[model samples]
Target: MQYFIILTFFLYGLVFGSFFNVVGLRVPTKSLFNPKRSYCDTCERTLTWKELIPVWSFAVQKGRCRGCRQSISPLYPVMELTTGLLFAFTYYLTGFSPELMLGLLLISLIIPVTVSDIVYSRIPNRLLLFFSPFFILYRILYPLSPFYDSFIGAGFAFLLVLLIILLSKGGMGVGDLKYYTLFGFIFGFSHFLLLFFLSTLYGALAGGILMKMKKAGRKTKIPFGPYIGLAALTVFYFGEVIISWYLNLFL
Candidate 1:
């Protein structure tokens, strides 16, 4: 039964992942609701159920449009599979709790934002605005989170981000500050701090490798959204374990 439930969530997540791909592609262009249907970019053929079965369809089609035989992006199936795995893991962690629901919604929002940021080197304020209210309301209803922690997190993170921006002078963008504040709202002080640490560490490692490979130079702009989203997700899912490990190691 437990395994079945996890499988069900995985399947459900795949469906959501397909929609998330739509959101990621369309939201940035402001075509999310107007399109009303999914179509192939190359052939402009509307996809039917058979062609839109998430990862399975991509695999069967060999990642090509049926009408034009043009190659489709591997990101489609990758997004579907990643979302599916995360959904199953989240279900295993939180079961049917409110955290499970909110976490899934948060993932839906972050995935698109991450993709757009990576591609365009910009984060959409519109997307962040869309989810901010939901984050606030979730906090109010849940009431399990610390009261002052979120405020402190928002303040400290905002200031810290602003300071970094000013000191670095165009090294980071305003969108990052907005995103950092959003992270604080979702995670509060302690977890937000940890998320920041992990994100910085990951970003540093990636940047170093990229610079070494000559793929990116010193002035090359790297989008911070993906790293922040990734670190936030990591802290959200494994925060207690990470905290406990730290405690055991130190004290």
Candidate 2:
């Protein structure tokens, strides 16, 4: 029965992932509802129902658009598969608890933001605004250990990021400031601090690798939103385990 429920979540996740792809790609451009149908970005041809079956369609089409025969971006299938796995894993971890709702919400927010950041090097304010109310409502309903930690965390993150922006002078953007502050509210102070560290660590590591491969120069701008999303997901899933492991090392 457990496995069956996990499978159901995975299937539903794949479908939602498909929608998320659309939302991520369109929201940044403000064309979300203009066309009203999924169209091939390369060819601008409307995709038929058979062409929209999540990961299956990508595999059947051999990663090429039938209309233009252009190779597809591969983001579609990857996001769908990732969402499915994440949904299943979240279910396995939290079962049917309220935490499961939080987990699902986190995944939904992270996936679309990651998609937008990867594609456009921009995180739409609209996307963040859309999810902010939900997160606020969740925190209100199930306040953290001191409750005020949420507000404190958010304020701390805002000030920290603001300091960074001031000192570095173009090192980060307003989008990042908002993103980090929102996550601070979601994860509270200690965990939000962890999220910040992990995100910077990830961004640094990725930048190093890209430079080593000569894929990017020092001046090349790499989007930081994906790293932030990854760190948020990590903190959501394993922050407690990680914090405990660290504390035990000192003891």
**Candidate 1 off by > 4 Å:** 212-214
Q: Which candidate tops lDDT? A: 2
Worst 10 residues of 1 by lDDT: 141-150
For 188-230, candidate 2 gives per-residue lDDT tens digits of 9999999999999999999999999999999998999999999
Using TM-score as the measure, the top candidate is 2
- TM-score, candidate 1, is 0.93
lDDT measured at residue 235 in model 2 versus the true structure, 0 to 100: 96
What lDDT does the true structure give each of the candidates? 0.86, 0.93
Q: On residues 1-251, what C-alpha lDDT tens digit does candidate 1 reach at each position?
A: 99999999999989988888777777777767784578898778888989999999999999889889999989889988988988999999999999998889779887888777876777888888998998888878775355777788889899999999999998779989999998887788888889999999889988999999999999888888888988989998988899889989999
Q: What is the C-alpha RMSD of each candidate to the true structure, in Å?
A: 1.7, 1.1
lDDT (0-100) at residue 236 of candidate 1? 89
Model 2 stretches with alpha carbons more than 4 Å out:
none
